[model samples]
Target: MAPYPPPQEAATSTLAERVGKGPDQNPNDTITTSPNCNPNGQESPTGKKTQASPTAIPEIQWYYGKHESRIAYWLLLSGAKHFGYYPRGTFNPFPITSALRRMENEILQCLSLAPGSRVLDLGCGEGHISRYIAREGSFPLVLGLDITASHLAKARRAISGDVLRGFLRQGQVEVRLGDYHDLFTSGTGIKMGEWDGVTAVETLAHAVDTKLAFSEVYRALKPGGRFCFNDYRIGIPDDVVRNESDGEVDEKELSPQQRKTLKAWRWVMRTGGMKGSEYSYAGTYERLLKEAGFVDVKVVDLSENMRPMARWFWILSLLPYAFAKLFRLEKAFYNSVSMYEQYVEWGGWAYCQWSATKPAT
Candidate 1:
């Protein structure tokens, strides 16, 4: 065989094949995992820079706080690997695969971005959305910030050679590692103002203080500049489900099983070097945005039209997760499995992408 061709599919697969196994795998294992899509069979706890963080990762409030959850962060990285990525959903006539594009387009349309609008992506994972807007849409600038150095490394690497001067044209979308929740207090140290718009995507709820995060975003934007995002965040109070929360994890209304699953996820986050807080699926985000002084908030149903896909994707993504919870393998195999699943070629989630504005003068 004259040098087997190559994966040529993705950099990740090719990189995975470079060594006998993944970076976390042991060299002692003789069994090869190349053919297996789930290649984490031999992965083990990599004591790789696990000093923990203080306010980033939500599980361990100690030494390994957020600094240890590198695996969980890969979930976001997988999405950013592709510019036109849609979180697979189950809705028909517009299944998760099809509707995701429509959903992103709807959100962009709702924002009414101009030819050269400036946008900011808070917690911009791998800067994929910003990359799309910058390279494809020709935006003026799209700045992204995060708290983890590893994520920033991947993002910076993805931006790659000449990305600043070439593909993006204006060389916009600078991805820096910083804490969005406390940017204002810390004073970003960069020239303030000149921001045309802002976005958070699926990252705002991670802040220990959602109100503070929105407030910072409010302070960062130019008047009338639009701010938008589409995350599985909490909606305004309505005829959904009754809630009686003091904003604590222990007081939520989810089933015991849900709580257990969430806890398991958090544990993995700590081990993998990512940041997350309690599930904000029930918090009052609409009211907080209003309180933060954002005008013309549009919390549309990103999932209503995709109910079918939501149900299907929920099964594909969450069933195994539920099983992990039941078997206590969440920390063992589930962590890697869930991380890998996040990279599945396609999925359908009744996702919500919201658009809000800063009141034009």
Candidate 2:
């Protein structure tokens, strides 16, 4: 076999393989998972060689001092029933805030499956989504997979997170540490005609490679199984530059420089741990999904039904991550969160939620 890569090779790291890339998130909760580490091209549980770097290009986003981001987030939101920015930490605040409870209800509705369905929640933080599926009175088996040990750790310590109010609906819920990329490469994880459903919310943006990510999802599902989730594409607007075709600009269709800048945003995320990729106009997303092997792809503007609260939530959502390391506000972190929350409650912000699905056999 080929020699393994170096320590910086994220895909092969003891930590990275154990869970995919760590999720940089915190809204109302957390997500976690675990697994072995092997940097080789294949998933050799054997743990025998060196690691291989997943990419030739540097990543755009990374978990820059993420541990600090997590601490700042939880400390700031203590005792709050709902975050209004990021529900349970993995879902979105935009759709929820925009449509009141409708967005949440709609997503839950979209996820409603017949009994005995096998479901996978990628980037399942704190197991809330899986918990919901468990209580959902539908899926008999619900699995939430995430790449953050802290998230899995917190889920394991559900008693402490207090934030993970999972359906408490029985042992139907399981949180595991694994990467979607590896999950795709490992055919056993998905039986050819086995899965009934697979759902990912607000997570595709975090994948190291979106195109390959969809292909993995496609391989995991049975024909006709719905691969539904809200994800971001490549085009988003800056303060300037508007497209003539539509009221807004399509960054995907922009000039080369704009395209490079757009892609660079993702680069910053890989290195800095911030995400600006995955977010683009719905149409552009539709095109990419088809190119990725996802058929019958559709984009829904759940944001139309979104509330101002979600906008408010995402508007200041970056605070914890942005300031966590710079200020190392460890001592006054709680105070900072409190002030931010108060500001959001006083002001309002919202974001869009786009849901899609994979074609069944």
Task: State residue 351's C-alpha deviation in candidate 1, in Å.
Answer: 3.9
The RMSD (Cα, Å) of candidate 2 is: 12.9
Model 1 lDDT at residue 278: 35
The residue-by-residue lDDT of candidate 2 on 24-68, one tens digit each, is 232333222112222333333434221221221223112312444
lDDT (10s digit) by residue, model 1, range 161-196: 435335543335556655565453232333335567
TM-score of each: 0.60, 0.57
Each prediction's number of clashing residue pairs: 25, 44
Best by lDDT: 1
Each model's C-alpha lDDT? 0.48, 0.46
